[model samples]
Target: MKRSHIPPLLDRKWLAPLLITSSLSLLLFLSFSLINAKFPPPASGFSGGGSSSELPRLPRLAYLITGTKDDGARVKRLLQAVYHPRNYYLIHLDLEAPEGERLELARYVKSEGVVREFGNVMVIGDADLVTAQGPTMIASTLHAIAVLLKRAKDWDWFINLSASDYPLVPQDDLLHIFSYLPRDLNFLEHSGDLGYKEVERARPIIIDPGLYHLKKSGVFYAKERRSLPASFKLFMGSAWVVLTKPFLEFCVWGWDNLPRTLLMYYTNFLSSPEGYFHTVVCNHKDYQNTTINHDLRYSRWDNPPKQHPITLTMEHLDDMVRSGAPFARKFEKDDPVLNRIDKELLMRLDGRFTPGAWCMGSSRAGKDPCLVSGSPIVVKPTLSSRRLEKLIANLLDPETFRGKQCK
Candidate 1:
């Protein structure tokens, strides 16, 4: 059959347009496919057939619980008190702690059935030397943050605690209450007014030997003082902090030079942990407004406050509960008050996890219900959640929330 032949110019023009159209179509299809692959259609429900909009996803907390010599037992107890199937825990015992203690803690964490199953808990094998009121403490915290960012991909917040600290509320209660919060808010006690710290902390140049030497040693003053930094103002507050993951990523990766600049400036500052994060968070424009001016910890300091808070005891239990703080500090190892807290506040027994909705097993014969685990997303908050909610409401009040930020 003789087919009609078009002119060469007409054929070229038609073939070019056809090729161009095919390429454009392919490029668009590939782009749309990639977009869909990255972000799939929202699910109708998480489990049963229901609207997913009704269910709020709980936020995950990444905790860096640190301790020093003879703190292994306290660390273990604190881990048990705060342990949850959904949250991630990184336990670090400082260089002052014996190798045996670190190994013991690692063994204990590996041995736990629930912890082993969830694989959310980690122990730092190579520990840092954290000097009291020194830059090494800040360094250790930054190290932990870096490790957490590298290891976990979904945590919403970073909470730094110590072995001396104990939780007053269960993880489920905390997760339930925090799920309602704006993810960008950062809870930290910060103040730009550095009265005594200007003299005792800011001006003084102390060298933390822990940054160099492997052995633990006291930080020594340089004798010469440096003037206050004009580039950025100094802020100081409690060492305990609960910070958003985005803010921490900024601090760790430091797309801008502000974080690294402040970090270097704070290297010689006394009690850098108290001021480093405060200063960093308050000075940066992007994060300054996110500050919530609270540490979320309860501690009773002596009149004119000492280097550390007074050891919490039975006498302070009522006050602690009234404070509505999630955690409290400076508790003596194996204190009787802790036992009372376990029995009453946490509803936990000896050598058992604090029970929550995720716990599925029966409590028959005083069995640990958490021994059998269920879906961690299921949260059943208690009366304690109400208390925490009230506290958060007060903190987020329009009059107080913005007024106290970065001030």
Candidate 2:
């Protein structure tokens, strides 16, 4: 309609070429901007053009540290040992803990200088009822996983621990070694053989009071027992595990109905925590091949295995180290071995966090190196990393990794 008002420039032969050039220029600029936004420059210290081998992006771990009545102190201690600026933590004190203790734990988390600065640690405002032998325990773990999935965005792995569990190496060592690993792999000790568990655990129908009652009480066994599930094969292993975000997302989101279905089936199964995840992971084709079949925890059991693992003491230190496990459990409060581990392995002071590259402050005059924060992506692996590397190597060995799955 404006043809009558066309200027001499529009009539020129160069006008068409100029318009095409301008359109292409605008489109190219937008395309470049999107590419830049999608992949920003690496952190300051990192090198290379996107290969993880040249400069791996440090991995972050999300820990669910749970406790009961008299476990606040131990939970706090465990927090200090595993705390890092780059990672996220969720602390849960069960309903058994008094209100004062819960408040104290929340206050402690809020008061810590580094925690306040990074804003990474969280104490659940409401506690979950957890009965270890019943489905409620598994429910609590899933609840924590769901919360972590919603609250945090960058964690690579999710590890569940109790107040009694302690790390054998500093967070830096684990982070450094894990940076090289594939993010999809999951570390858990699982087997398809249910032998004795089939009778003692799977067949027993029990109801956990924690699931419904406000006050915690023992689970009651029902007169009727259910048969083994026909839809899915049962698997059993250690309750402790190191899992992945994608797998846990599958567990929590339930886009595929398998997780929800199995969860309902295990609601009456005794010791559901040991089998729920194991069964779900093994039955799914996408996740089955990703299993590492190692819990990465050190524990000593009696000859025939008792109700619980033996409490660790100084005598088990060498064995714990030699096993190349990253964590161990069932330590009494204020165990001497904890002090030894703090001093020798973690290089941590009594109240300070485990020392790592991020801790740039002075430690020369008994000051906490973690007082000052540095680049979070930098990792300084120590001798402990060598043991972990070996452990990973053996577990991932072609013959070993494939043979240990589902079966």
Candidate 3:
């Protein structure tokens, strides 16, 4: 080949291509950073372990803070109350929320100095279909657990919370006590639908569109009803639960295949959330003994019973604290009782981070003092921790603890 014709391109073209490739690589890197900055992980919760001689070493929690249509602010409040550096968080907004709300929630997560620093929180880019009373609720929870497991191997517990729910005790109080608990224990309420089958819920069949559809819609019913499962006993309880990582993994992996089958069978079952965790825990041999028979929430149902549980108000403050439950649910948005709880129970004010032993800043009068974020450890259990300590003690007494297993 002649020098002039020998692809003059090979002579200097190599440098141009190299420069172009380098520039593209740099641009790609910067674009990724900006995308991450804008959409940051949908994280809205935190976790850490506290001491519980009655329970094992305190375990790290992986929280899934999920919300639907217009829940951005509620999720933000939930995340702040529960945030901790020692655990993992995955925030999820259902497909119903507008793009603006999703982006707004993401912006809030990224703007937090602590959230950006820890980098343990994440947002679900593709939100799941979550119906109010469908098996999809269970599916969504399992999906979160699967994602958390895939992302980090350190969390010991998996807690699910809604935008409507709030924590009564600080994470530090909960962590301090949970540290002394067995890692395999599961907390859920159980009534077993025993004599209650005649009631509408146990006998009826319903379908949730959230598992399949995009727009928000109520669960549907089928005329051709089916009988209950003969293979497994049916148990029912509160939708909210505090599940151990082991149990959640079992539900997701289901080496025995029960989890998947129940998921399918419950597709038509009414209020599946009330039964999914209950049935799974009751039937699993390895995990049945770990069931704690309590939902760890202070939910008050009406005297004769109503579709929705009674809402907590300022009047319920004393009952809430005496209940010994660490969390409560179904409060109105920005209720005055929330302020009372923050002032009296959490010592949180001014919409700042809740101060804990990990927060080294000293407070005066009513100022929020979490500005100085110190070592993430060093839990300071308060009188609230003592209340929880006593409550957990009674629950774990050998007579009650062993006797209540899977009953």
Candidate 4:
């Protein structure tokens, strides 16, 4: 009586409806269970989506693209040219810029859907003061590196650049080549002599007033000059570099005193960007073998030499492409040669970012194809990247690499 008219659910043999209901219920239960199994976006960036989800993944780069007052636009352009979802970036606008420009730069970077989703792009909330030819130039760069280290440890290398600098290759071109290189390798151009620069840059004991006072100002030379460093030999070269993350960590945290000592030496040294990294790499035994000796950039110094590099124009286009450099610098804004580079070399058109294999959008009528993004990890190396590869291969030759160290 207690079981009156109870449906014999398990007893029904060929009961399609009953079996269907049971199977459907089971399926629903399993479906709901599967929904609960998802982990949050991931504590670490690695995932299981596909090739993208598998493995530890190659690595990321932390970039410090710094500039002064009116350079926000150039900084933005540089960010676009070098943007890769896999990389981390920190754009810093120095105290020289109006607060409004810095705010706009931050807003633009954060607002870009790609950047916001990746969560790898950062703009310095607090800006620093850097005076002309002052140690503050080096300080500003260090500050950005510290911020990057604190923000993300996923990076492999640290590249320092200014807005005046523009990429000659896509980020993928650089990253693909870099992925194969030893993690300890640092791309820096150095010279042991320092040339006539010895008297002007090395011996001067200049104080960067901007180091203390908030307002931007030029370096103020003290009455006295300092002698050449005895503890470490001074090696000077190009200011821009692609530095290994380990070296940067060593430089910034500086567990050893070599970096700290060099910091003091360059405190009064002119053009510290050129000397700081050069000295750090050559003096550090652990990293001395990692130097590439070439800056990976195409720069044309004036025939007679000037305070700045010669501005590249159409005349330099063929030379720039053939140089096998990943970047070139000091172009006049919106120069025609840049457009030519976009068309002939980069396959990019207009002022938009140089589209790479990662760009999947349409390119009809002078549009930005990178607006539509695709696989962030896919790298389609160009003849240009291959050319660069050859150059790098030659530079890393046993005969070449060892012989060129700190020479």
Q: Each prediction's TM-score against the native?
A: 0.87, 0.87, 0.83, 0.83
For candidate 1, lDDT tens digit of each residue in 82-189? Answer: 988888888888889998998898888878877877878888887778899888898888888887776777899999999999999988778877766667778888
Query: Candidate 4: RMSD over Cα atoms?
Result: 18.0
Q: lDDT, candidate 2, residue 288?
A: 87
lDDT of 1 at 260: 79
> Which ranges of candidate 4 are over 4 A from the true structure?
1-58, 362-369
State the displacement of the C-alpha of residue 395, model 1, in Å, after optimal TM-score superposition: 0.6
Model 3: per-residue Cα lDDT over 1-407, one tens digit each? 00111110111111100101111111111011111111112122222333434223446788888998889888888888887666677888877877677778777666776666666677776677777777677777777777776666777788888888888898878887776666666888886644554356666788787766777688888786666668988888788888876666667655557777777777777777888888888896666777778888887888766666898898888988998889898798899998888878887774576667766566877544566666565566677877777677777766777677666
Across 238-338, the per-residue lDDT of candidate 4 in tens digits comes to: 88898877777778776677778788778888888879989988886777877788888899997656668999998998888888888898887678876
Q: How accurate is candidate 1 locally (lDDT)?
A: 0.79
Query: Number of clashing pairs, model 3?
Result: 19
| Residues 301-390, model 2: lDDT tens digits | 998676579999999999989888899988999999999999988888898899888788988888888889876666666777778777
By TM-score, is 1 or 4 better? Answer: 1
Worst 10 residues of 3 by lDDT: 8-17
